[model samples]
Target chain A: MSLDNEQVQHIALLARLRLADDELGETVEKLSRIVDFVDQLAAAPTDDVVPMAHPLNAVQRLRPDAVTEPDDRDHLQQNAAAVSDGLYLVPKVIE
Target chain B: MKGQWEVVIGLEIHTQLATVSKIFSGAATAYGAAPNTQACLVDLGYPGTLPVLNREVVRMAAMFGLAVNATIAPRSVFARKNYFYPDLPKGYQISQYELPIVAGGELFIAGDDGAQKRIGITRAHLEEDAGKSIHEGFDRQSGIDLNRAGTPLLEIVSEPDLRSAREAVAYMRKIHSIVRYLGISDGNMQEGSFRCDANVSVRPRGQEKLGTRAELKNLNSFRFVERAINFEIERQIDVLEDGGEVVQETRLYDADRDETRSMRSKEEANDYRYFPDPDLLPVEIDAAWVEELRSALPELPDAKRERFVAQYELKPDDAEILTASRALADYYEAAVSAGSGAPQAVGNWVIGDLTGALNRDGLDIAESKVAAEQLAGLVDRIADNTISGKIAKEVFDAMWAGEGSADEIIAARGLKQITDTSAIEAIVDKVIAANPGQVAEYQAGKDKLIGFFVGQVMKETQGKANPGVVNQMLKAKLAG
Candidate 1:
């Protein structure tokens, strides 16, 4: 499960993180420790144990299958970082 | 060639739960909110913020388990899947791992033979969605929109039972309909409301061991999901044929190019460093709560389709299409209850004329101009001969145009059935007199001219003439 130095750098680049040159060696070490821990999970006795999908075993209870959640404009607008009256504010696209 | 290879295909479908509030907070789960506007302190990943599990989300996951006839664990744990992205303010996602909400269930989908194929459900766990990263701005940095950050999602994983791309789409659709039927998700792909991830690989025929699989990421549409899997399978087969191993990795489906490209190699569990979240308690669902949810469950699609067949004598295909959506089924039933006639007649009107008009206008059953009861009333008018079927079409057109009730439309337009035999006979006699040569030909043994007389009578009465009465009167005049 352990990744080499090159693999760690590749993962960080894919994730779009700007780690410093000094941080790469430490990151590689920390990630290696984490990988070793989950490798132990592979050895657990999963042969007899059915992989658990859900916590309960039974038929599902359902609603009337009608639309319940509706959008409320004024209230929804409360969370915006920028707004003008009722509309959201974004950087102008056109001159 | 290798000894034996088996393709293993599993799917993880992410469906947005139709809840009014976020899964972990009281913030509204409305889409299209301003960037960061919907983010409460907890959703924003502010310090010391703890997540409180939304009861509705847990119940929804349980309902999904019930629908698939799966095992629901009384106790499940939420683990933090750590990752870094600009949109993910929490830097880790709280999701179910070792113990998911539901397990060991089977979803029944339509196979190529049109028979039921039970696909094994690996797990369906509850999780919160990440925020959106808006890169449309002209800058090096993308803006983050946290409106969807804490929205509730049910991640349903399926065992690799699907053998082909067709089976993959069928499985996804079955899940979509169930979530929609349970009123859990809208299952709209265009809005990113429903999304899919597929794990695909290729194997030789009659193999046991699975091949190295590639995970295709976030295919929003059903077609994209199918195409992505098919393309990846081809890619893997070609790679193996070229003496290269099919590396285990996550791939992206480029819809624009209809191809899949490597995004990143598959991450081992250590990459995420999954750990049980400290702020959240182990989700312990009580039996009583499950029972309450079960009691509130509506008639599912299967049961409803069966009932439609048994009660209405509808064909299997007819029943399936009519009950595709709960709203459409409800509308069909309402029409049936409001009228007294054969179910087939009502079904024809509903599925044929009504559905056609609705589709033409890009409307669903719920958005139809005619209410269920109102439609039934119109059918009743037709069944009782208050209006001919031909005239009923006109009435229906008027109803579609926002004209009032069936009776009101009929009265306003004077489109009543013309069953007055005496009046029709007078018109028929007049037409027989006007066409002397044809009438004489009819009496001289060309009996087919009787149809010509009926047409003339119908024209005289402006199509209000009941064709049955016109036929009878025309026959009597020709015989005498």
Candidate 2:
């Protein structure tokens, strides 16, 4: 897969990142190189191998189904950019 | 118009698991908690914090798999679905991508013609829920409540097997009943414990290729799902008939307007670049553990219904009604097990009178004022000739009003049947003497006047005369 300028801008918007007009060309070029480097695995003859999702094949460790956390809303909301009535406020999202 | 086009639908249902804590954290999962109060560092995606799986979520997923006879994957992977939204503190959601916990099951639903149809379940995967974004209160901002963040959800995806909106609703209802029976989820649509998204497409009759589909999001009720699908089907048909192609997009069902509106088009659709989550490991279930869970499973709806039919000698429709909910089935069984009345009578009272009363009072079987034993007592009275069925109904009314037991009501109101032969004989004689004209008319050829004589005798006895005794005495006296 190749990353073009238009696709890079679209991804930036989806990620809520604002890129400068002058930086788009360089960013697109760098992203395309990264994609090309990852695409090198396509040349490998591995049709018989199973796809791996994790580096270590260990199973997940499960915690008991119980409530162990306390109410720390007043403290957690302190890190938000804005808050009101125990809610984290952001610029309006229409949908 | 009926045979013009074909509608194809698939559903994605998201059921919130009934766990005390969040899926990957120890934070509380109680609904209606204050905003952000239940969110911990792991839920909020703090630096260096990692997610630990909750054991109950896997058990619930396995229970659902067993209920649907789905293939329970021995090993399942978690992937991060990348997206940017204010409600999601993490930039991505941990979900299953390549391998899900459940795969390739079938749900049996009643088709439009009342015949059983099997809908193929493509997959059910485990995922964490996003927080709520409240957009109504703020003037130019939205508020995010993270109490629901990291709550475990099983997203069940179905194949494009539904041919109409009715079938889709039936399929959704079958899933709803199964989850409720398993006691894994509350299945409360109003509180959003259960919600569904529908993918709908319409094609010309006998077309092999499916048309471009539109997805309807967050249909919380069964009625809305049906209505939304029907509207979408009509809209697609209209578009195609007008020489236009159907566009693929996500639409929102505006319940107030009773129509769906475009929420996002294909151009703005998020890529959701999915990758396996590094912090979490794959989930693996041993065969022994799966067997243990399967053996410990509760009797599901279908088996219970069959048992009711065979054991209680109930009609299939009556069995279906009784087994609609576990509480109702248990209630019926308890009443029968009280061992005071016939099973069929118990079945009728439970299905007919008791259910009617409960519905009128807007109560569930669990919330009923009439206990199973109390209902058994009422049915016993009718069986043993202590009170007639008519009087039993009166007793039921009194019992519903908290008046007391069947015996107490019958005794307190002098409502017991007049089983004494002489007492009934005297009333019969009084009716024969008082209604001499009707008696002569009855003996002369008007045999239907026997009903009038019976009514007169009943009126004299204040409806307490045993009807059979009254009829026998009235016939003997009239013949003489």
Candidate 3:
């Protein structure tokens, strides 16, 4: 379950993060701890234990495939950092 | 140079519950809301903000369990699924582990070989949704939309009982239909309202041990899920045959490229350090609430399909398609009731012209321009010989454009059926007189010439003449 330096670097690149050289050593330690914890589950005797699907035996209730909500234009634009009329605005480069 | 192989496929589907509010908060579970507007501070996971479990979500999870014929636990716990994403404001998702709301149910999927195979329902649990991360929209940095952050979702995990892509898609469709029929999820794929992920692995035939499984994520459409799974299965098979091993990881489906690329290794449950959410209490439901929800459920898809076949005398194939959506089934029944004891005619109109119009206009059955009663009135006109089938089609087209009731449109456009015998007889007589050369030809033992006279009568009546009446009168005249 232990990960080497190269494997740690590869995982970081795959996850879309930038880590410092010092942080790499630290991440390796934390990640290994996490992996070791998950590995404990492999031995908890699942041979006779059926995986749980749902907690209850009731059928899932449904709603009419009806459109229940209206499009909220004002509410949609309320949190915009910038707004112009009905549209959202952001920084522009070329005119 | 060949070793035998067997493929083991399982599906993990995330179905959003049809609840009015988010799973843990009172924010309206509305899609397409303003970013972060639907989110409350609790959903943002602010310090000191406690999470409260929505009782309705638990009831929904329980109902889904019952529908799948799964077992229910008297007590279920929620745990935090730790993950880091911009859209996930909590930095972790509230999900189920160790104890889920429902467990050990199976869905019977129809196999291609005219038999059924039961896909084991490993677990069905209630969970809160993560916020949306919009990777597009004019920037390198992704925007975070939390409108869906607290929305309640029921994740149904299925065992790797599926053997083929077809079975996987069939299972998905059945689940989609069941949820829709139960009023659980809108099951809309376009808005990411109903989504699923697939786990695929391969093993040698007759082997009991499992293989390294790769999980495919963000499949928004049924077609993509099927294609992605099929492609992944084939890819794994190729890798194994070439002496390569399939690594366990999380894969992202690039729909544009139609391939699944490895994102990262799959995380185990403990990766999140799934501890019970301290803010929320464990969910508990009494028998009374369960019975109430059960009574409120409409006739599900399978029962409705059976009734359509038995009561309406529709073929199984036709009934399956018509009752696939509850809206269409309701529309069909309304039209039949309006037709007044003519179920077959009603079925034809709904399945044929009405559905065609709906598709052409890009509308769902519930959004059709023609009401069910209007369609009934139109069918009655045909039954009473007020209009021929050919003209009924024309009237249906007009009605679909919101031109009012069939009678109103017929009266306004003068498209009523020509049922008067004398009126039709006059056309027949005029045709007989005008076509003397052809009549002479008919009398010279051209007994098959009745169709010629019928055509003339139709032209004289401007295609409104009842073909039945016209043919009868023409036969008598030509015989003499």
Candidate 4:
């Protein structure tokens, strides 16, 4: 129901984000408060209720397996930081 | 290999669905395009882009479920497997987590000990593939090709029933055959259409507890699957033999070195915090629709192999080989029915020369230059004694070269069997008369000399002599 500084730091790490040492306390408190608010739902008696994938009672909409999207690489790559040979370049990943 | 240690292997095969577009987007899924041309806004992980399920992929997953005798889950949920990778633009792969599309299936594979062994399918879940990380030709950076992103993939996880690397490959091959038969996947490993990751562990012969497992990744080929599992098993056993504990980790199989190494340090390794994605709802498949897909599925490998053995009177091994692929089995059956060739002989032709030619020319059975009826024509010639078995190979070669039909080729090349008894007798007589010293040697109790005379007769007839009739006539004449 609550989170610790270390747990929040690990969560940040998994999300590929960094929480500064000075900002860690505030972030952990905010995350813990948010978790506690959501955790209240677990206190309710709902043993007979079916688990839901979404709050809405609707099923996923399916699309026909057809190619309708056009080449939007140029438009999309305008937002990227780097590009080469039509490939989006990033920092070296593999060791 | 299996020795004092018992190796248990399980495989997770990622089969790229043969859908025309990406699983969640309308972007094209064609491979090897102009890098990012096929990638769209949704595939590029732009904010506010949502994924919609592709109907064809759901149908394909159900078909595979039925083919493997698995249960198609009526309600399947998608989850986000959170990870950080440059190739995965979304930073989280949308995959099935708690509930999957297909579950509790079993596939029968040829066991390493030469028996049919049943391998359990734990589950098969639909997921999106990550883009390619082009590490080559980049200095201190990696290039990302988003064309592969959002492509549909069915991650089939198998239970650890395989006892050896051979069994693992056999199971992988069986799954490959099923997917290909269902037309759900092209199953092309070279182009990354099909990929496999194996979890291998070793145990003592009588040990009930399994050893620590190392999940081996990047095994894209069947041979690599077998070799990687074998190498990982040996590595584990070696660690145990030296009194060192086998560490649980993800390992990468180095195809160049033929060994597996730990992919990342345990400290920084991936811990995928999987949760239901809020953007997508549960996919509800109707039981009747599953039945409809079942009716549409082609005869699976096992059923086809059994039918081949019964209908064609073929040996089990031969039937197995002939029914390795639906196209191959269909070709064999078509060849058998379209003409008067015996089913067994036609099966042999399809499994032998046809397969040989397909392999030699790097052609799929569907791309075979020779049609089934054409091959059946050649088989019919052999069956009817119009051409000796030896000469049929020549006819087959000519047919492969687009020369013409068997009858046309035989007529044009004068390659027909010398079936007329008198004509064949004349050649046999000429051969005996021309080789008198060998004939004298044949009469002097050299029984093998009949082969010499038969060869001479075949040469005289230009290999057109019916081999069976030549043998009988040669035996009778050489008896004197």
Candidate 5:
């Protein structure tokens, strides 16, 4: 499938990415190629096989309900640019 | 004003599961912790962290599925709901999409005509809750508390079967009661453990097609759910009558203003881009495990109500009220066991007096000042004819005041009933002799004077005479 500039811009907007006019054409072309490559697998002839979520056949492991983690907020928030009273701060989002 | 129109409502209730830890991490799930003290690396969506399934959450979902008669999937998948928000550190939420753990069930609520109404449950799925974002006292920024993030939530979706606000409240309340009864969630709306979103719309009464709906968000209480839906219904009708088309959107319920306004920020964010989460494999719950949870299930409300009717021989209304909560039902049964084996009498004290005192004092059954055995003692005294029912009220009030046991109070107050035949007869003779004019009127066929004689006997005995025995002896003395 071929790509259009408008669709690419919409996807970028949804992903919170700002693409300049010069970057839009190349991004559209690359995304179109990725979509086409993924679309090729739709032609496979395995009619009875169930769709799988992962490559491995192992099932998800369950953990017993227990609290083992200690207070690590101070250490975890060290990488953030801003924090107050142990809360991570960000630009205000409207309700 | 909407006699020609019909309202349709469906609800999505998100109940936080009561777990000791987060859904996929070992972080504590306790509420009201400091902003980030309880958050772990996994909850923050840190690098190289993989989400694991919690055994209790899966069991909780299965118990709910069985309780509602839903189909528990043999295998369920988790999908990533992609969105951009600060509260969601990963920019996506782990939720069940195509194949949820529970699907296709119905819960019965009392309809408008006082009959059982089955509201269809579309599906219930497991999801991770988002963090809390505090906008107040922040300079051009919002403070994000990640403690609530990754906490387990069961989002129950219902079909658009509700017809009115009252019915909606009843349906939501039924779900709340079931979750609490199952011991899965605390169902505390004030603490944000249970909340609902309502999809409301209206159309002509005979129209089969549903009108465009506006989703009302953040209805944290039963009253808010009702008021939000009502306001949205009226707003839609007004729009349609004014030749305006209803726009499908998300609206915030302004509880203070009693109105709903379109949330402009969420207007264009409907594309969730859902896909299977690669970090987690499919969760497979076999039949044996499902059966184990089923066998371990507690007695639900419907079964308890039925047993109350058959075992206790209680009226349906009384049974319903007594079984409204597990604690009340347990209290009633314990009282009956400790009392004179009179189920109906014990049930009456529980449903009438105990419930009234609890409400008047702003307390719950669990917080009642009177204990079950103490109440039983009072009922036993009344049954053994040691104290009249009238005097038992005073005893009960004294009990509520923490005076002492029923026996002690009765003895200290000198309020024992005069059940002895000769004792009651002597009081009756004294009353008859003292009120000769009224006795003549009574013997002259003014039969209503019997109440006067009974009153005099009670007054002379200090309201301690058995009214039944007093009536019999007074009638015999007045006749001959």
Candidate 6:
């Protein structure tokens, strides 16, 4: 499948990315190439092969369900751009 | 409503697992923590962070699968569902996609007609919760609380087997009780421990193909789910009747307005590019572990209900109510075992008086002030004729008020039954003498006046007179 400029713009909007007027052409080219490269694998005849999820084919490691982390709001919130009442503040989000 | 259209409903219930920590992080999962206080570095999705699966979450998911008799996949994989929201700092949620932990189970719920209907469960998968975006607490800005982020959740999806809003609620309630009985969730709808999204659609009668479905999101209560489904069903039917196509979208249930409105159209749907998370591995459960967990499972509600009917000779309805909650079932058994030899009597008190009082006080059986032994004592007093059933209720009220034991309350208030023949005879004589006109009417074959004399004797003895003795003495006196 080929990606069009409109499709690329829609993807950008979904990703919450702001692109300059000049950046759109280059972005569409790069994303189309990536899509084409991935689409190439559709031609590989491997109907009987089992799909692999992980490279190492390893199962999940389990952790005990105990509260091992302590309350560190004061320290952790230091990374936030803005925080009030212990909550990270962002621009108003409509429903 | 019945013959014009048919409603097709499916439910996706998100049950927060009763885990101490988040699914992927070691952050505390306790509710009511200060904003962001329980969130840790791992939960914040800091760079170079990895998610480790919580074994308890997997165990809980497996437990639910077993509870519903679903197939537990020996191996399950976690995937990242990519999306963008301020509350989701990771820009994606860690959830199961292609391979979920549980698959293909059925829950039997009572239909509107009281017959059992089986609802198929499509899958139940483990996932990490998203944070809360507080849209109202700030001016021109929203607050993001990560406290709920990364919390363990088991999202159980059901096939569209429900036919009406009532059936959907029944199915939700059945799931709710099962999770609570498994001790896998607190099932607190108020706290969002158990929440569900309802997918609703409508079809013309005799139509085999399903109509377009509108998903109602985040209905946290049973009543809301039912009402939302009903409203959605009616809206769809109306739209179709007016030659309009029902649009597939996500809707929100405005419980205050008792209506559902479109939140987002299908055109605006997010394309969640789901892919296997390379950070986490596929979970593999050995048969030995499954067997061990199965053996440790408690007696489920159905089996307990059957046993109650078979062993205690309780009515099926009574047994159903008693076994609705594991704690109540255990309380009933304890009361019976605590020397309340009359099983039926004990079941009655537990189901009738005890449950009534508990509900009136907005308390659970575990939080009930009346202990099992105390209830047993009350039941035993009635069985042994120490106190009439009516007086036992008064004693029960006293016990609930923390007055004392059944014996203590009876002794303190002199509420014991006037089982002594002479004592009852004296009250009977006083009642007969006080109501001469009624007595004369009774002697003239006004047999219905026997009730009036019995009431007089009961009132004189403070409802402690042995009713049988009072009747016998009154009949003998009036007959002479």
- The per-model lDDT (C-alpha) reads 0.80, 0.90, 0.79, 0.89, 0.91, 0.90
Q: Give the TM-score of candidate 2.
A: 0.91
Q: Compared with the true structure, what per-residue lDDT tens digits does model 4 show for residues B347-412?
A: 888888888998999999899988999998998988888998899999999999999999999999
List candidate 1 stretches off by more than 4 Å.
Answer: A1-95, B1-9, B164-166, B211-214, B223-251, B254-270, B422-462, B466-480
Query: Where does model 6 exceed 4 Å of error?
Result: A19-22, B265-267, B440-447
Please, what are the lDDT tens digits per residue for candidate 6 over residues B1-480? 547787889999999999998999989999998899998888888999899889999999999999999999999989999887888889899999999999999989888778988899999999999999999868999999999999989999999999999999888888888999999999999999999999899898789999999999969998898888888888898898889999888999999999998886346446887989889878999899899889978888988999999999999999988898899999999999996489899998888899899999999899999999999989888888899888888899999999989999999998888767887887788878788899888888889999999999898888998887788888888898
Better of 3 and 5 by DockQ: 5
Most accurate candidate by lDDT: 5
Q: Candidate 1 or 4, higher TM-score?
A: 4
Mind giving the per-residue lDDT tens digits that candidate 5 earns over B1-480? 779999999999999999999898999999999999988988898889988889999999999999999999999999999998888988899999998999999889888778999999999999999999999999899999999999999999999999999999999988888898998999989999999999999999999999999999989999999898888998999999999999999999989999999987765499899999988899999999999999998998888999999998999989987887788888998898888788888888887788899999999788999999999999999899899889999999999999999999999999988767888787787788788899889899999999989998999899898888888888888899
Model 3, position A51: C-alpha lDDT score: 48
Candidate 2 backbone overlaps, count: 0
TM-score of candidate 3 relative to the true fold: 0.77
Query: Which 10-residue span in candidate 3 chain B carries the lowest summed lDDT?
Result: B264-273
Reported per model, the fraction of native interface contacts reproduced equals 0.00, 0.89, 0.00, 0.97, 0.94, 0.91
Which has the better DockQ: candidate 1, or candidate 3?
Answer: 1
Tens digit of per-residue lDDT, candidate 3, span B170-194: 8888888888887788898887778
TM-score of each: 0.76, 0.91, 0.77, 0.96, 0.92, 0.95
Clashing pairs in 6: A60-B282
**C-alpha positional error of residue B457 in candidate 6 after TM-score superposition, expressed in Å:** 0.7
Where model 4 places Cα greater than 4 Å from the true spot, the runs are A53-56
Off by over 4 Å in 2: A52-56, B238-244, B264-266, B425-462, B467-480
Poorly placed runs, candidate 5 (over 4 Å): B420-462, B469-480
Interface RMSD of 5: 1.2
Report the error of model 5 at residue B283, Å.
0.6
DockQ measured for candidate 2: 0.77
